[model samples]
Target chain A: MTGYLVRRTGQMVLTLFLIITFTFFLVQAQPGDYASFYVLNPDLPPEVKDQIRAAFGLDKPAWQQYLIHLKNTFTGNLGVSFGNFPRPVLDVLVERVPRTLVLFLTATAVSFYIGFFLGKAMAWRRGGLFEYATTISGALLFTAFTPAFGLMMIWAFAFKLGWFPVGKFLDPLVWRGADVSANYVFGNMLLSAAAFIAFALLVMLCLKRFGRRVPSVAAFPIVLGGALIIVAAWALSGIGGLALDIVKHMVLPVATLTLISFAGTMLLTRNSMLETIREDYVMAARAKGLPDKLVRDRHAARNAMLPIVTSLVYSLIFAIDGSVIIESVFSWPGTGLTLLQAVRSEDLPLVMGAMLFIGMLSLLAHVIVDVLYVYLDPRIRYQ
Target chain B: MTDRHDPLLKVDGLSLSYQTRLGEVQAVRNVSFELARGSALGLVGESGCGKTSIANCLMRLLPDNARLSAGRVLLDGQDILPLAEEDMRLLRWRRISMVFQAAMNVLDPVYRVGRQIIEAIETHGVESTDTAARERVARLFRMVGLDPQLMERYPHEFSGGMRQRAVIAMALSCDPDLMIADEPITALDVIVQDRILRELKAIQQQLDMSIIYISHDIAVVAEVTDVVGVMYAGRLVEMGDTSDVFRAPAHPYTAALMSSFPSVSGERRPLTGLPGEPPNLSDLPQGCPFHPRCAYATDVCRTQYPPQARYGSHWAVCWHPLDATMAVQS
Candidate 1:
């Protein structure tokens, strides 16, 4: 475990370095710098504009400016915004990072857990009614209008029916103070943690209990109830309220993203399972007087999961890059949205910061997947 | 009348066919045999002669397209063909288990070998406690001549022979009454094959389990099995005690098969290879399927199929049986 952690941390540092290098060069290659934005503002005196440019070291060579940016980034100084906000780029990111993490993490957890078991079910009952329905729905929902699909859902639930708030981070009333009472804070934290644990446990138990059996009458109702309860509890809490609002705002985007992602994952898992099931060892497992479900899960599914794991890591990296469109559609303040704003305003520091963060995240995802590949499959190992 | 001393498995007039996009392919036709309890019966044939197909049908492991056109497979006294999928699941691995070819590669690489066995046991409602399951797994490993300590290792950690042994241990986990070993030693080296066969024989003696062993090697079958069946064109051409079939093969195909292998005793004879490939099931020649390849083909042999004739305990499905006169002349 210690060795794994050490390797992962080393890889993470290398990834960050690459991200910083790429961001530095890419930002320098852009047409204009922070000085160009200031030059466009006619109200400012020419001397004052030159003084402002000099203050930020914009007049220096691009290479020198890049070194200064790197030093400032390391020392917790992201420099000022170009849109006259007078705030550091880091502060803007800090305020929005939590919101994005909450929304994305929740969606990821929900989608992964749900999609995995559903895919398993579809594979197990390849020709049955439930499997047929899921395959068709999954293909249709994901293949058609991925991004617009999310908007369609938002229109139906929030705009058409007024079932939930349409778009925003939160109500802002609940989390107004950073240093709230310990009891309230702890209570909220415990509730959120407990909820997460419960949902995870429920998903695991469902997968375990009904893994082999055909789709029972109770399957759909039980899953629907569980999803409803989770959504309700999440929308009711302070942090959850913020998360729920983001989710509601994200309903269309996530749905669109999940459709395409689900298609890829489901196709991969189904093919792997099908191939693994035909292996001679599978017959050996069946010959052991083991039940069909046990043979499928413990023998077939476990082996098939190796490829799925790799695909998931690649998907995560792709997701970070793909979030730009979703961010624009929802108007949710995130790195993707902030980067776009920086590009338009010619804020070189902010653009580099956002790009570097995304690039690092992608690299980190890749490293994590590579390390896990070795552990999950004994065939792989570092020399 | 059901003989109390009869074999544990009896497959009578079994005919199996598979439907493909082209047409129906008759893979196994009118095959009949019995496996005495605690004894091994070897099914030997070339690749397309339906050895594996027969095994699959006996285990009811055929794909969705295959159909058992005729005959009955009696496990003890129960018919296996009409059994429900769930009922088959119950009987499989418990009453009748299989050790398939290339089975070493079948272990779940993600899990430890011990946990996999434990999962198998728990799935069948064997051991409720982890301790009990571990103890059972250890006992199984010991029975297969493997160290119990190695159970914690992953499948990839074990050598080929060791992995096959682990698979054997799993097959024996439930103390199955009948174990179908389908070319279990085919993929191993000659040395490892000898070792695994020896271990299997010992385990059979200890447990008194009947095994339906399938192989293409006539010599290997002679060493391990009491009775042997030689198949040709999806049909059993000859079947009898191993000594009887090897010493005096009635069916020409069986005679050809025996001569194909060089005997260790240096009693060498010119091998008479079968002419032409095995019949294509979708478009088989009329009448006797083997007549086209048989040297003693006549008008009767080409016009009508031969019925199985019993001579003592041995049976042969040939119009012109290789009696002493024919054998000497050939």
Candidate 2:
């Protein structure tokens, strides 16, 4: 397995290199560079525009410019953003990527758990009314366009009902400066640590109490109890109102992403589970006198989970590409929105920077998935 | 004829049907057999004759669409039909386990072979501690001619025969009272098949448990079974002691089946193939299911279902039962 990981890591590096090479050339292949945007300004003279081009090395041949970009990238110099002149591309990305990551990563995790378990239940009660209802509704959610769905959510929940704010990451009117003081940050960190320790103790308690009675399902309460404790600890801290406001702002966009992806994930899980439930091993498990739940979870769900895991890895890899349309629709200031504006304004530095990060993310995600495969399937020998 | 002293397993008039999109298929019809303790009964038949269905019914392992439409499956003194699904689950594996036909593919590929068996043992609440279960699993592996160390490997890591042995070890883990081996060695090579059969016979003797061995190969069944029943078109056409059934088949279908198999040390008789095919269960012929393929089939055979005819303890479904005196006359 170690050997396999090493080989896969090498392959991932090569893949990322190829992706960077292609993206760099392709973005440059356009008629002009970011300097052309400056040419359109009435106050700028043609000679001044020419100087700006030379200073930025856009006036150099494509090969020379590419080599320069490669050297700068290797030296950790992402260059100044043309869109926001004098600001480094890496600095701009560092500010925006985490927000996008938090939003999409949380949404993906929430939707996966919901969809996967719901799909398993649907398959178990196959041909029943519950199955039909979930299948039909899940299909509708899966097939709906993302932008349209996001808009509908915004219209219904935000605009018409006024249940949520129309849009933006925060309500600036309420908090004035919503960023918390460093003292609060330190306090929250301590609380978070306390919550983590408490959660671990809770799980041990649950295991001691219920593990022997229900050996197959003892871990479930630990996860559930742990989540409750962490959330409770956060809410009980002095900054609960601020956290609540952020969660409130997150509702619409997160819901839209969750609903849309939940359908597809659930459907995929259901179909794969249906196929797995029919395998001869399932029958063997059943014949072993295992209860219905254990048979489904231990024997059937583990096998059905393979395809779902693959899709999950691919989704994570592409997540950095941003949910561009959803971000635009919600007016969420994430990297996806940044990528769109950068491309439209022909900010070559920012575009290349974002693309590089995305390419790296994809390669890293692939390696992580390969590593996880060894744990999920023992038959997968590294050699 | 059931009493307090009835056989360990008595399947009386067992019938099952599957409801598909097309229609209902009567997979097993009025199939009855008794298995005493410490004996093996082989149900021999071609494909689609409901051999596997019967095995499934015994374990209550049928799919959602398939139902045990009629009859009672008596395990010891308890009728399994009326048992709650939850209760039936307890009966399965612990009381009556099954080795599926695709034995090689019947283990979870993601888990170690030993872990899979341990899962069964643990699920059935056989052992309180993991170490005790591990020790039992190792013993089972050795009993089935497998190395205890090989238990750490996944299903895909083992060869076909080894996988079958693992499956057998799993079935025996709980020390079930009845083991239903559904064509356990059909997919294996000749040498592996012989070895597995020998291992199975040894296990049977050592464990002293009844087995319902379902297979298509008469020769394979003869080597392992004390009693044999020949099925045609979902009906048991002939049944008796294995030796009597093989030496003197009362039913023409059984006789034809016995004649088709080549003998290693006997007169070289040209093999006679049974003509035509088994009738479809959804739309069976009006009379005897085997009439079209039976050379001895008469007008009465084609017009109505044959009554049960007896010779000593052996029995067959036939209108014109072969005479015993004719054996000397011939």
lDDT of 2 by residue, A1-383 (tens): 57766888788767766766787887887777777877779999999999988888889988988888888887888898988888999988876666676678778878899999998998888787888888888889877887888889989999899999877766766566657753354346445646766777677677766554555346666767777877787778756676666668778888888887787678888899999998999988888888888899988999999888899887665545646777888888778888889988778888888878777767777767777877798767568
**Model-by-model lDDT, in order?**
0.76, 0.83
The digit string of per-residue lDDT tens for model 1 on A61-180 reads: 888887887788778677877663688777766655554544455555565666666766667678878877877877786576645865776688768998755655443555466354
Top-scoring candidate (DockQ): 2
Second chain of candidate 1: TM-score? 0.92
Give me candidate 2's TM-score against the actual structure: 0.92
Tell me which residue pairs clash in candidate 1: A150-A252, A281-B106, A289-B93
Off by over 4 Å in 2: A1-7, A45-47, A177-238, B1-5, B326-330
Model 1 Cα lDDT, one tens digit per residue, B208-241: 8888889888888888888899888898888889
Chain B TM (all candidates): 0.92, 0.95
iRMS, candidate 2, in Å: value is 0.8
Interface DockQ of each model: 0.63, 0.81
